[model samples]
Target: MIDYLDLALQYGGFTSLDKVYLARKLAGLTDQQKLDFITPPPSVINAYFAEIYQKQGAEEATDYYLTLSQQLSLFPKEPSFAEEKPFVRLNLSGKAFGFAYVDGTGLAQVFAEQDVEVAENLLFEIAQIFPHYVVFEQAGKVWMKGNDFDETILMAEETEFLLTDVSVSDQFVKISGLNQEEVLQAAEKYDGQRYVAWSGRSAILYIKH
Candidate 1:
């Protein structure tokens, strides 16, 4: 196994925490994915600054990568502690996903693609990969999968407005345990985009600008 941590350090563009997360993420990759992540030599990245100094293992190469990371500003990432943790990070076809418990939810499922397996086969295979979160596409909608899920809770008449379904629109945002004004004020900074952050059980959603 390649020492991802040392590789990140040698790259020298990440903070201590970011490197740890980067290493963890890289460790899960198939070998091909790791190969795809290699940074091209600076000359290939930008010939504007291209010089003979762009060769690999050269000090200039290190400086160029460092400059690239700084230009990208892909650092200082801090994890958010939240009430609902994500089941898995999906590397889907340009789609990102995360979900919250709508209540009475149970079990965790993980799914990456829907090309081969049908629903019955997926359900059977899920147990083989026991104790891992599953995600799958159903009715053209993506959802987390779990065998123990009791969907009855979804029909509860007492459903207090859920940010997910009740209202989700561009400029709409939710900050759990906050009032409408606070959530809206936060959205104001977006100049507007649909977003939400979960913490406690309750949250205020802003549906309009």
Candidate 2:
């Protein structure tokens, strides 16, 4: 396996102290080896940098990913902690482009397509992959795959409310738990597109700003 500690220090743009702390945390590697790893030839360093940049688009993704440990605490664990841990980091590579980490909830994937035609086609393809999906409108409308349609869409608001029944307007559930400020902020940040899924649960919520 690749040495993640060395990689973080070398390419994560950490300060000198950060590098020292990272070096200390690394297992088994000698100081000389770590130095050599950092002091590679110019061409090799540039290639390494290029590869790192290619794999990770920005710091945000890395920061978000590292927060998995903290996020785990928000959820109720299974009978065993061993079984509960590694849920979020349990990424099946190439499964999806984006994923959400919910507390008691499950994981959710978000696919944002600028092209309507492409998105529509992808939506159909996604439905075929899963039996049923949740549907909601972001800045643009979206269709989910799953049986819990009411749970997902009912959470959608004209501005940001849930729709209990697609055919009827009377039945609805206002999304609770999240504070009003957070909801407003999400609406602004997502520009009206926020979908959520909880782990081990079929329920999916599609939030539209």
* TM-score per candidate, chains pooled: 0.20, 0.24
- Which pairs in model 1 have colliding backbones? 109-133, 109-134, 110-133, 110-134, 110-135, 111-135
Model 1 TM-score (2 dp): 0.20
lDDT of each: 0.35, 0.36
Clash numbers, per candidate: 6, 19
Candidate 2 residues 1-209, lDDT tens each? Answer: 45556455545445667766776655567754543344324344344434543576323332333343232232223312232222222112233222223332333333331223334334433433332334343444343323342543343344433322111113333332223333333334233344433222222233443
Best by lDDT: 2
Model 1, position 10, has a per-residue lDDT of 46
Which runs in model 1 stand beyond 4 Å of their true positions? 38-209
Best by TM-score: 2
| lDDT (10s digit) by residue, model 1, range 89-204 | 32333433222222233322233433333343343233222222333444533333332332233331222433322333343322333343344443444333222222233333
